[model samples]
Target chain A: MTGQVRTVDGRVAGRRGQETRQKLLDCLREMLSTSPYRDVKVIDVARMAGTSPATFYQYFPDVEGAVLEIAEEMAKDSDTLKELVAGKSWAGKSGPTTSEELVDGFLAFWRKNDAILRVVTLGAAEGDKRFFKIRMTVLNSVAKPLAEAVKELQAKGQADKSLDPNAVSGALVSLLASAAEHQKAFTSWGVKVKDLKPNLAPLVYLGVTGKKAPK
Target chain B: MTGQVRTVDGRVAGRRGQETRQKLLDCLREMLSTSPYRDVKVIDVARMAGTSPATFYQYFPDVEGAVLEIAEEMAKDSDTLKELVAGKSWAGKSGPTTSEELVDGFLAFWRKNDAILRVVTLGAAEGDKRFFKIRMTVLNSVAKPLAEAVKELQAKGQADKSLDPNAVSGALVSLLASAAEHQKAFTSWGVKVKDLKPNLAPLVYLGVTGKKAPK
Candidate 1:
């Protein structure tokens, strides 16, 4: 049975290896809730997960590799996002986007995973190399749909056709990212997230639409 | 004199108090350059500064307070930033903002001070209440001139007159604050700060002129 398991390093394999891997990932997720990747200690994490340090070493070279793997797995499950965007395709393909549709999607995305994002983004900002790489991977995932909308509008001649879609995509990405930040701040100050949409909606709407929100 | 220097707590304020404070700031800043703010510890900072725990306790009520003071003080100095945006004022008014002027000031400012800004802004998302506050104060200070610029544009009717200068100001503030943040990551990657203006100038210019830079 022990021979059946292949060790990435000189550790036991198979079911035992799988268990150790899950244990490390679970411990990592908990730390991700409250701290960035670099700040977490491998020994502390292993101990918390009830694994030995040697066991942890067998699966992951370090904390960053563990986190990057977990985050990538989580982001791969985009059913919720797909469901949200699917119902609202922004006018079957044209003209300025309604403020409600664009703004509401952004607000909902933040509320769903504020803690996870705050942690992952902070980890990526530092030189947690693997974590940083996946962080951009997740960003590009979000940017994909946004790029589609920009392209859709350009095809219909409503969006700025000549603008670099990449640049506009970056602006939209940064805007929503900041909105997530502002929402968190508002929540901290006891203001509700729902309340912020009214203030934040029009800024993005106008920037993208090049006009006022329709009543 | 000692009484005057003492904090509200019973800790004595003397030459030692000042030295302890300076040491913490210096150590924290150095650590933050190579590491994220959330990853740094008060003990690590105190140890590097060669100060005892008792000495650190005598100065700051907590680590956050010490870090806040350093970043806040950095924000207060306008010589560098003033020079950065000074002649770069809105386009219609006159002279093209010299690449030399813009690049020099931006390079000088970040090359010298990015450590603190990185700590202050990046730490905000980590739920550090002190860094969050310092981030806001630093942002507000940077936003002042941009606010003045928006008002000037609105007055000229070059930009949207109906745009709430305050909201536009807030949006603009968030933009640069976010830029400064990405700038830190860019700097860490060996990208030159002087080279950043080629990318940045167009963003600011697009923002003021209501025209996206030619793709």
Candidate 2:
């Protein structure tokens, strides 16, 4: 992450600047906690964070920029998860066990960050410019390794040769994304992440392997 | 199509009524002519229509309502197209054939009333209670048949049976939606719909079928 810019007053680079920046983010997350992304406004964010309107402009260009920064950080976290999912193969009789690991890793992450992700998801589900666009980037990044994994599986004849593993790879990424979104939105309020896994894991498996497992 | 509600003199109804309603829609369209859904607003709409605030509300409840009424019509067009496509067999065929009919129908409608849709889309893309919730009704109405079409295609052994047709179906809907929003935002600058078809068709096909025809 880039360091907070300073005016060299040496008073922690000015109380206003440090407070405003963190305040904006604090407000952004708080607003997101209550509602979706499109509903939050720059003025509203400024007020919630206990900062002034002018101070908001000093820190970010517009609501989009402010939201973009927060979304970007969440995106980095999403990428780390995507990386974990994309690089491995699913375990069959003779192949590596990436699929099971992928499932367990994803569910665990989803359970852990369920709240923040619920807040950040407005970007994806709402089609916010800063929201959906970032996901498109993450998906493109995840696509390459996933394609490689699929190709390897196909070459080993561990997966269905008739299907395009590459396409399935991207589809798997989408499946997990939509599933997580669905879980957050529809899973009974206060439903724990542990409750999510039993349904989601099988659903994810079906997406990747095209098999109706014993769910 | 629902005919315009008329007054005692055979004009559009009370307050600023029919003529005013038409003007508001026309104004909203003009505002979107150069800008995008993401950049325009109710005040701009009222300004362009040359109407007062009270007059704007007489015809609809809010800004989104003004634009949403028209989008409801566009979504109806989508449904008619859905019926037409479902009447055919679209299994395993995720090439130029399936996408052309689907994309072309939306584009044709999109061409005739790009402005209203641009504004209506602003709500449809967001998840606002007053805005997006109504949009979702139209979305589900449109997506339902497409979902049925995929299920039918899978049952008929026309599409990829091994894949989850519902997941693929939802993916296709998201693809079209993503393209619509993208085209609305990007094309506001000057891109032609006809020029877009060739490339966009293939991309959405890939999104749906998750396969590319030997690029």
Clashing pairs in 2: A89-A98, A90-A99, B91-B158, B91-B159, B92-B158, B92-B159
Query: Taking the tens digit of each residue's C-alpha lDDT, what string does model 1 give over A1-215?
Result: 42544456665567766877887888877876667444678888888898788878788776656766676675665334544333244442232344455557755765566656665666665656655655555455555566666667678876666544545455555656665765544454343666555545555554454344454
lDDT of 1 by residue, B1-215 (tens): 22354653765567867766777778877888877666677788889998776667667776667777777777667434644544455653331353234434544565577667665655677667766776655555444565567678778877766545555555544555454455434443334555455544444454444554443
List per-prediction Cα lDDT, in the order shown: 0.59, 0.55
Residue lDDT tens for model 2, A49-141 = 777877777777777677677767766776676666554555553122455556566656555555355444433443456555665555545
Quote each prediction's TM-score.
0.68, 0.64
DockQ of each: 0.22, 0.10
iRMSD values, candidates in order? 5.4, 9.0
lDDT of 2 by residue, B1-215 (tens): 57766533455685546667788877865665666445667777877777677766666766556566666666556455454356554444534576777767655654565555444444433344444444444445445666676666566655555445444454444444444534433232233545555544554454444444333
Q: Candidate 2: deviation at residue B175, Å?
A: 5.1
- The superposed Cα distance between candidate 1 and the true structure at residue B197, in angstroms, equals 5.3
The residue-level lDDT of candidate 2 at A204 comes to 45
**How high is the TM-score of chain A in each model?**
0.74, 0.71
